[model samples]
Target: MCSSVNAELLVDKQTFTSQNFKTFNGNNIKEVNVGWESYGNLNPQKDNVILITHYFTGNSHAAGKYDVADASLGYWDAIIGPGKAIDTNRFFVISVDSLANLGVGDPHVITTGPASINPDTQKPYGLDFPVVTIRDFVNVQKLVLESLGIQKLYAVVGPSMGSMQAIDWAAAYPSKVERMMSVIGAGQSDPWTTALLEHWATPIKLDRNWNDGDYYAGSAPIDGLTASLMLITQNALSADFFNQLGKQTVPFQALESEPLHDIRKSHSIVNWLRSRAQARATTMDANHLLYLVRACQLFITGHQHDFSKAIASITAKTLFLPATQDQLLMPYHAKQTHQALIDSGKKSQIKMLEGPLGHLEGVTGISQHTDAIRAFLKQ
Candidate 1:
C-alpha cells in the first residue's frame, strides 16, 4: 500500500452558477468552490498540456504526496512517468479534484460538498451542498485550467467518472481539447450503476446515528456506511473473476467458522468494509451524492437529451477503452458511446481492455494499454 501523503492545498476559487440555465431538476442556481493540482512545467507555448480527470473517489494527488501514502507517480503513475504513456518529459500534466471528491487529510483539496463551510450558516455544508452534474464538473475544470494559463489540452485522459468528465470536455468545449480518452466509463451512468450506488448510500442514510446528514458534531454513520461499502466492493468485482475464486462456496478447510449475530461480532467485516468505504467517502455531503446521482440520471445528449447530438459535438480525436471484465461500467457502454461518435461523424475508436481485475483494471495493472494510449496522444 502506498503511504498516506500530506494534504497540499491548491487553489480555493469560487464560481457562479449559470444565470441562463437552471438545474435539470429546476433548482435555483448556485456557485461552488473547485480545488485542484498540477504536474510538470508548461512550456512557453502552453500547448503541450495533458489533463487528467480522476475517478469518483480520487483527489488532486495524481502523483505521490507527503503525509498520505500518495504514490510519487500518482494513481496512474505507471502510465504518466517521464517516458511513460503521458511522458512528462514532453508534456505538462494537470489534474484537478472534482467538486465533491472525498479526499481526506489534504488541505489543498476543495469541494462544495459536505465538508465545505456553508457561506450562509458559517458551518460545514454537510448535506446542504447543492447538486452538481458532469457539466458542472467540466466547467470547474475549465476554470482551473484557464487560471493556469492553459487554453487547450493536447489530450484529456481519465477512467470511470473521470472518463465522463473527459467526454464532457470534448463535447462542451470542443475547440479546447485536441484529443480525449475515456477508460472504463460511459457517456451516461446506466441504471445498473445507479441502482447499486443507491444501495451503497442507503446504509449511510439508515444509520440511526446519522442525524439526517448532521452527524459531524458527533459520530457519523460509520457502521451503515461500512456495510454499504462491503456490498459495493463485492459487486464491483466481475463475475468472471469471482467465479475463479468461487466466492459462493466457502473453502473446505476452515480454521474458524462461527455464526455471529451481534454487529460487534461482525465488526471485522464492518471494519474491512469501512476501511474501503471511508477511502472513497471523503467529506462529501450525503445530499451532494443525491444531487450528483440525480444529475447522472438526467444525462441526455443534445438539447433533447438525444445522445446522437451529444456524440456529434465531439470535435477532438477520441478514444474509449473499457475493461472486458468490468461488470459495473461494462464494455458495452463504451461500445455504445463509440458507435454514437461514429454516427455523429466524429473520429473515434473503442479498444476493449482484456483483464481480470474487473473495473479496477482501468486503474491497477492498466499499463498493458500504455503504448496504445501513448500513440493516441502522439497524434
Candidate 2:
C-alpha cells in the first residue's frame, strides 16, 4: 500500500492563458487556460527540464505531497523525488493538466470541459465545447514551455493518455524535445482501442440525466459514470489482480429491496467493485469524462492515416514501455509503434513491463523498471 509522507515540498499551481486559441476542428475559443505544477529548480541553462504528461482523470499534481497529512503523495510520487527514477535532484519536472480534464473539484485545475461555463452565453459549454485532439494538447503545452523561456526540453515523459501526449510532443515539435518516454501508450488509436472507448461512453450517453452533456445544474449521471468507471477498472488490471480484489471481504452486506420481492445478493466481489466505482463517480463529472473519451478516441500522431508516416517526423530518442498483461491497451500496439519508428529510421526502443497489474503496471508497477528507466534517461 502507498503511504502518506509528511515531507515539506512546495507544489504550486500556475496558469497560462492564450487568446483566441483555435482547436483542430477549426473552432476558436476567446481564451484558454492550462494549469501546471513544477517540481525542483531549473538550472541556469534551463536544459534540465522534463515534462510529465498526466493520464486519464489525472491533473497537474504529478509528484510531491500536497499536504503534510495527505493520504498519499502525487500519482508518480514513487519515481519522482530527490533521488527517484526521474530524480528531482538533478532535473526539474513539470506536469500540465490537459484541457477538459477530470477536475474532480480541484481548484488548481483550470480546464475548459463540458462543465465549464461558456463566456459567450455565460452557460456551461456542455456539448458546445469544440472537440479537441492530442495534437491540440501538445500545442498548448508548447505555448506553456515557450512562455517560460524554455527553448528545449531534456525529456517528455508520460503514461497512458499522457504517453499519447508525449508522442505528440515528439512528432509536433521534434526540435524542442530531446527524448521521449512513452509508457502503456500507442502512436495512434487503432480500431480496437477506438471501439473500446465507444463502449465506455455508451453508458454515459444512455443516462437520462446526461441531457446531451448539459447536466450541470441538475444531478450528474452518477449511475452511468459509475458503470463506465467499473468497466475501465476491470480492464485496467489483470484478471488475477482483479480476482484478488474480488476475494477481499467487504464490511457491508449486499442486498437490494424491491417493491414485489427482496433480492439478496451474496457475491462480495460485485458489491466491492460497485462500491469502488460509486466512490470514483462521486468526485468525477460525467460530461468531463465523455469529453476526455472523445479526445482519446480521436488521438493519432501527426494526424495521419499512415502510422509509419505519422512517426517518421519524430526526431527525439524514444523509449516505449508496454505492460505485459495490459488488456486495455495491448502490448502489440506499443511494439507496432516501436517498429514503425525503427522502420522510419528514427531511434526507438521497447521494453515489456512484466506484471499482473495490467495497464496499471505503467503506474503501480513502475518501481520494477526504475533502474532501466533511470539508465535510459541518463543515456
Candidate 3:
C-alpha cells in the first residue's frame, strides 16, 4: 500500500469563482465557486500542465494528504507523484471538484450544489438548482484553466464521470487539449446506463423526509440515501470479488411481530452492505448525490446524441482504458467510444484492464497500467 505521507505532495484546497454562470438548460446562477488543488509547479512555458478530473464522488484532492496527520490520501495517489505515472517532476497536475460534487458538506470544497444557498432566493437551491451536464462541468474546468493562464493542456486524464469530462474537453475545445486519457467512461450514456442512474435516484426521491429535495434543514433522507449507495456499491465491484469478500446470498423474509429477530437472522453480507452504505450516507448529502447522478445521466461528448459526430470533433490523441470486470460502466462502453474515434479518423486506442474490482478497477487497479499511461503521456 502506498503511504499517505509524501513529502513531495502539496495539499491545499483552492477556490475559483465565476459570475453569472449559465447551465446547459439556459438557467443562470449569480455566481459559482469551484474547489481545486494542485501538485508540482507549472513550468515557465506553461505547457506542462496536466488536468486530472475527478470521478462522480471525488473532489479536487487528487493526490496528497490534507495534513501530516491525515489517515488517507487523495483518490489517485497511487499513480500520481514526483516520479510516478503522471510524473510531477515533469508536469504540473491539477484537479478540481465538479459542480454539485459529493463534497457539499465539506468546508474545504466550495462548490455550488443543491446544498448551496441560492444568491437570488437566499436559500438552498435544492431542486431549484439548474440542471448541469458533462459539458457544463468541462466548461467550468476550462474557466479554471484560463484563470490560471493555461491556454493548452498537456493532457486531460480521468476515470468514470471524470473520463466523460475529458472527452468533452477534447471535443468542445480541440485546440486546448493535446491528449486525453479516458478510463472506464463512455461518450454517451447508453440506455442501460441511463436506466441504472434513474434507479440510483429513485430511493432518494421516495424518502418521506426528502420533501422533493427540500430536506436540508430537517432530517435528511438517510434511509433512502443509504439504500441508493448500497445499490451503487454492489455495481462498483464484481460478483466474484464480492463472493470472495464472503458475501452470501440470503433469502428475504418479512418481519412478523418480532422485527429484531429477523435482523438477527440476516446474513453477514447484508449487514456489511448496510454498514458501508450507512457510513457513506452520513458523510454525503442526499441532494448532492441526486445532482451528481443527474449530471452523469446527461453525460455526452460535444452535446451530440450521435457518438460518431461527438467523437469526430476530438483532435486530441486519446487513450481509452476499459476495465474488463466493470459491472457499472462496462468495457464495451469504452471500446465503443474508442471505435467511434477510430472510425472518425482520429488518433485513438483502447486497452482493457483486467481486475476483480470491477468499476473501481479504474482507480484501484490503475497501478498495473502506469507504464502504459506514462508512455502514452510522453508521446
| Best-matching candidate per lDDT | 3
lDDT of 2 by residue, 1-379 (tens): 0122444355767878988889888889777888888888889999999999999878878887655666766888878877788888888888888988876467657776677778998998888888888878888888888888898999999999999999988887888899999999988888999999888888988999888887888978888998899888888889878666655654333342331253454355666777888887776888888888888999898776766676888899999999999998899889989998998898888999987899999987787888988998898
Q: What is the model-wide C-alpha lDDT for candidate 3? A: 0.86
Each model's TM-score, in the order given? Answer: 0.82, 0.93, 0.93
Clashing pairs in 2: none
Task: Report the lDDT tens digits of candidate 3 across residue range 1-379.
Answer: 1232445475878889999988888989788998888888889989999999989877888887777877887888888988899988788899888998886777667788888898888889999988888888888998898998999999999999999999899988999999999998888888899999988899999999999999978898999999999898998899888887873454333443345565555556666788998987766888888888988888878887666776888899999999999999988888888888888998887888888999999988888898999999988
For candidate 1, lDDT tens digit of each residue in 256-306? Answer: 233144434433333444576776555434444544555555554332466
Q: Candidate 1, 83: how far from true, in Å? A: 1.0
Residue 57 C-alpha lDDT in model 1: 61
Order candidates by TM-score, high to low.
3, 2, 1
Say which candidate scores most in TM-score: 3
